[model samples]
Target chain A: MHGLFKWSSKWWPGVIPLVIFWGIAAWTSTATVEGDLAARSNAALKDTVLDKRRISVDGRDVTFAANAFSEDGRVSAVASVEAVPGVRLVNDETRLVPEAKPFVWSAERDVVRVTLGGNSPLPSSRSKLMEAAKANLGGVEVVDQMGLARGAPLRFDSATALLLDQIGKLKDGRITLTDTKVNLSGMARELGGREAIAAALKNLPEGYSVAVNDIRAPPYVFQAYKDPVALTLTLTGYVPDNNVHAAVVAAAGRKFFSEKVVDNLKASIGAPSGFAAAVVPALGALSRLSTGTLVVSDREVKLSGDALHDAAANQIRGGLGRDFPQGWQYKAEISVKPASAPVDATVCQQLFAELLSKGRIRFESGRADIVSDSAGLLDRLIETAMRCPTVNIEIAGHTDGDGDEAANQTLSEKRAQAVMDYLVRAGLPASRFLPVGYGSTQPLAGNDTEDGKAQNRRIEFVVK
Target chain B: MAALATFFWGWLLTAALLGFGMGWIAVVHRAQAVSKAWMRWLALLAAALVAASFTRIVPGRFGYWLDLFLVMFALYLCGCAIGSWLRDWVVTRSTLAARAAKSAQNDNL
Candidate 1:
């Protein structure tokens, strides 16, 4: 041994080769073993739900560290690594994934995009939720900020899917799920969207319950505008049904006799109760104005327009709410139309002639009772007379010469007086109106034909 | 773990082999002077390795062993120096102790 220990020149060169060869052999062998063990162990844990996995092998012994969702999962993961071929031992550094006490998850929407945040039970669930958000909210950007955690409720994926469906209906709002309870708050995109979301929540999975739902629907609106220049009473916005829609249009036609009715109302759900009843009275007040707009939103009635005079404005302001049903509110922004530039008797007479030529005042046959159909024309006559405030006007009543002459004369006199009374009730002084009876004597057209008689039977306003 | 074992064994073998080789060259061949060019080349190689290790520019998982090899190399150089000095002392003492006896034996022969 001593002789062998004695350093020799021949042995020195041989040692270099020997050491080099041993180094190469040792490195290659150990690398091969470590690499083979790692690959097999990783493959064994491929199907397991492990997070932040780290595996180190030391001569067939494995040190595995990871977060597992449950105790069973942690044990199973370690065992799977140990069962890998050539793995002699497994040092489990694994622990159960942290429990989320409340396990809150949320999806929020703004104008531009929707954001999905909070914890998810699994990676698969996280991706699934992101995909589901994209699918539900079309054309809206979906952002994901979810992390993995344990202690999620049973059927969490199903509840989240259902909740995501409601997010699309919201214009802007947030939906939060803490454990098995759901809390939602936001504004709905449309009028009936609140009810829709409420109805949808009823279908949530069995274990889940709603803790708070504060969705608000947009206002239900019904609007009418009277454009005097256009001679149109335009009705636009929502009505309860086709019947109520037709009723509102018909009321507008009746109230605004001279103005053409342009119906543009849509029949939709979520109209306030008594919508038609409220709209009709509101339209009546609107028609009494020279030009007006009526808007009914939810249970509130808002009428805005210029009344023909101060008395009419006061009447509308005080009387509009009286006809509305219980629980209905009204706000009248009534202002009297400014009095027109005073006109001389000559211009007022021509204005009456032009107005009378357009529409006739019809009275009940043989009696002096005026028909309600002529109220619009009477209002125009009153409005004209108001312009000629200083001028006294003669309200002449003519007959068609069909009835008895004495009786026609008496009826004509009474009808003329009724016209004077109507003008007086419309805030015009009674002294400005002089009742006259022409009977059949001053007929403008021959009473031989029905059309001639119809033309001849008229009430003429001659400003004096 | 296996990589560590490999590195440890390689360090021991290299140091032992280099020390033995340096001792034998010093004693038997009577060569005390080292080539300056060889020393410069060794210094350049060691500097490059140190820079690589500090910058972590060495690639592959096995590159971690570079720092270990550097330390081993430093120890091997020290072992070589000590081995050569020890070898020289032993050789000088043995030669001096046997010189007179060998010379007289030659005269008799």
Candidate 2:
């Protein structure tokens, strides 16, 4: 026993340290193997388009826990984990959550063909939908890619047919049918296409409802062209009513001064919202260009012209966008008109009249603040005045008969001064110019009409 | 009875101390490289010795074998737990250091 104890004591010290070292080595190998397997599993899972939120690694084993939107996604995730290097086994804890989305079906029309996509409840319903789409599209290739599923609302056939009928009215747009909810988005084919579709929707079958009808009518296009050589302003396109028509013509007369106004504007039902408000201000800006076109389509105003001077071009480019009503967008293409040869007083006066007739100087309503659109016109006038350097010119401001005569005169005088200030800023000698305000006493047209009132408010240059 | 009770108490205390020692060794070797199979065998041997020491409190030949098996099994578990823990610590520290170095290099650039 004594000898055995001696042997044990001698051997135990060496054995303890060796054992500890071995234990540490074993642990390191296990950890490394597990970590490598986990990394490989993660990389494999990433290659698959499955949403793997958590991954755990055991020795030669990997477990994937993820949320999948479909059965295919769940299967793919499991297969991917199994394919990882050193993974002997895979534990798939993936759960499938079928996409909970509205039952949507759409038919999109392009120039050459119509493409149909989304879900249909029944096989018969799919064929019926395709037939209807083909019938309405007429001669356009119909590519059907709609899948069949259960759970369509009742009266699906009649509702789809009604929607198909309205598709004929659209030039191009998507129609979405979710149960009883119908949403239409596209441009209308005709002038009153929106109204026609709305009227047609009212006749839908019982229990059928319209959720969102966003069909836009064709653009209500209003165009005006100013010709300085002919002293004529030609107006075209649709206006809302007869009253607006007469007012627009009279306004043209007032801005053109002695020039003739040609009215060819037609009365139509579907002018864009805020058409009247935007058109008048736009016209005021147009009157200031030498040879310019003002085109108002829907809520978009496009003005392209040559300004009478450099400063006017800058002002018009910077300010016209601001002059538009809120939510209205304006694009200006203003370039400076080239300087004309220096001329005598009489010739300069004629040039001024011609330039002014091409466009009008605009002001803020009821204020002397010159509207930015008027900058180009003022610039041209300044250029003409500079040519007749020795001659004194008079800047006259006039107002319509809307307000008190004295107040109108004061407002006109301030506006005239505002013009003179702009000219001085353009390097013109203030001493060479006189500002005068003519109250509503001088009527270019009767103030009873909106167009006439627009005409009466004017700014003129007189070579003194 | 008194002897049996003493043996039981002593065995319990010894087992507890042994467990604590093994745990400490695991922690110490966490960042060290050692053979895993050798460590597992050593743990088995230690557990068997512990069980044999407690066999004095047991009466009968069956108790001896039971004590032997139990001690060996417990020691095997201890070895595995300690070894695994150490390796994990080493790997984790090295990975963190490498990441930090790479980040510093990027920052310098």
Candidate 3:
């Protein structure tokens, strides 16, 4: 036993060095092989959307772990790794990305920005969706909160692109895609925006359908403002078409009798039912006011201003709603204009003289139809007449001598009556004014030049 | 678990064999006996190591190494106890058999 121990001691020290040398050699070889396999595997999956890739090698065996977006992608990744030249056996720890049973995605819009949320099947698809949103929504801010996933329906990109187009038409709303079904709800940006979106949705990709579309159109509005100072009824906002627009202008001309109709209205497609019928009465209510604004939005008529008198205001408040079509609403915030201080007949005469000196009352050619150009002058005259409520006044009219004496006299009388009719319509008592005509005899200027003739044809207000 | 065993069996078996050889040599050669106080301290130390490993109070890759070392150590200690018991049984049986043989020779004489 002693001789055996003496012989073993000499070899034992050499064995330690040999064991360590082999250990290091084995470690270096394993590391080199693992690094090489990892590089090859990474190259195989570089173009694919595999996440959290890890590769380890024991001799030629490989353990590959990654998150793959689809079962096919997972299998393909494993197969590719196994196909690598040095790989003997593959330990597959590859799992599919989380599958959304009813894959839901949404784009929501608020006042400031739009947010896109839910899952996307591929990174490329996610990037495409982001680009589409930014391109379609103009300068609006876009936020992306989408996750990578599997089980997205076929043609998802096509369907999502179509829905994103609809989102651009919304002022504020949300559009959701669950699998191949779509749900949309929100207010449209313009009058015809809702219909436009509905029409566009018809072009959605095949196998896609609308589940719930509750998009609401903006109110179809028509607005008019009566400015007593400007003597203009400004027509603004939208009209149904050119015909309705012209009709509305004509109605304003007749009802507002004394104000120039400044037509600022645009022709548009979405006017509510009974829009023309509703607007005529709303303009009538506005015309009864000393100054007022009328807004016809959708099926509602809102009139606000001061009427010429307490009786007019009360009449407007009580009667405007009754004149509107059924299923339409009316709101009148009517108040009476303050009555002017009473003035004597001399002061009333001076006020009328002062107003007429600024601008003369005008008539249309040879007819007694009062041209709207004289509306500002006539409104001031009526306001002056209103100050002397208890006094009597005579409106005298004279024509140029270019025509026959009898015809001139008849034209002058009709013009004088037109002036009196305007004042009476302005809530003045008809008995307070007497209209008279002179047949080119009472001329303030000569009968020679055009300017002279224009001056000679005049209407004067005299207090008694 | 099977993969872990396949990876670590070499190290664990080597540790157990080393412990068994040491235990067997100590029992057979009548080496200096360890005191109860030393045994208690070693047990406490092992318990502390187990606690640290289980709670993962140690950090980084070193913590993993410590856990693996503790497992190997526990197996080695189990092997040492079994080896010591086996050696004692073998020694006791041989001594009894030798005594019986000597008595049988005396009776034959």
Q: TM-scores of all models?
A: 0.66, 0.46, 0.63
What value does the interface RMSD of model 2 take?
19.4
How many clashes (backbone atoms < 3 Å, residues ≥3 apart in a chain or on different chains) does model 1 have? 0
Q: How many residue pairs collide in each prediction?
A: 0, 11, 0
Each candidate: chain B TM-score: 0.59, 0.44, 0.86
Candidate 3 residue-wise lDDT, B1-109, digit = tens: 1223444566667666655655455455533444557656866987998888767566533444555566566665556656656676788899999999999999999
lDDT of 1: 0.79
Give the alpha carbon lDDT tens digit for every residue of A1-464 in model 3. Answer: 34222222222222233344335434444455556766777787777778677887655467899889878888989999888875556789999888898999899999989999998888889999999999998899999998878899999998888888888999999999999999999999988999899999999988999999999999998899999899899999999889988988987876665578999999988788889888987887787678899999899999999876655677678977887788999989988788889898899999888767656788999999997535535656777788888899989999998889999999999999999998888678999999999969888788999998988899999887
Q: Give candidate 1's fnat, 2 decimals.
A: 0.01
The better candidate by lDDT, 1 or 2, is 1
True contacts kept of each: 0.01, 0.00, 0.00
CA error at residue B31 for candidate 1, angstroms: 20
- Candidate 2 docking class: incorrect
Question: Which 10-residue window of candidate 1 chain A scores lowest in summed lDDT?
Answer: A1-10
Candidate 3 fraction of reference contacts recovered: 0.00
How would you encode candidate 2's per-residue C-alpha lDDT over A3-118 as one tens digit per residue?
22222222233235434544443344446556666777777766554443588875445667876645786787888888765455567788854332566777776567777787
Tens digit of per-residue lDDT, candidate 1, span A1-464: 23223433223343455446545644655566667788889999999988789998765567899989888999989989977875555778998778888999999999999999999998889889999999888889999988789999999999999999999999999999999999999999987888899999999999899999999877899888989899898888998888888878876776676789988888888888888878888887887788888888999999998987776677778977888899999999988889888788899999899878877777998888887556656767887888888999899999987979988788889999998887787788888889999899888888999999998888998877
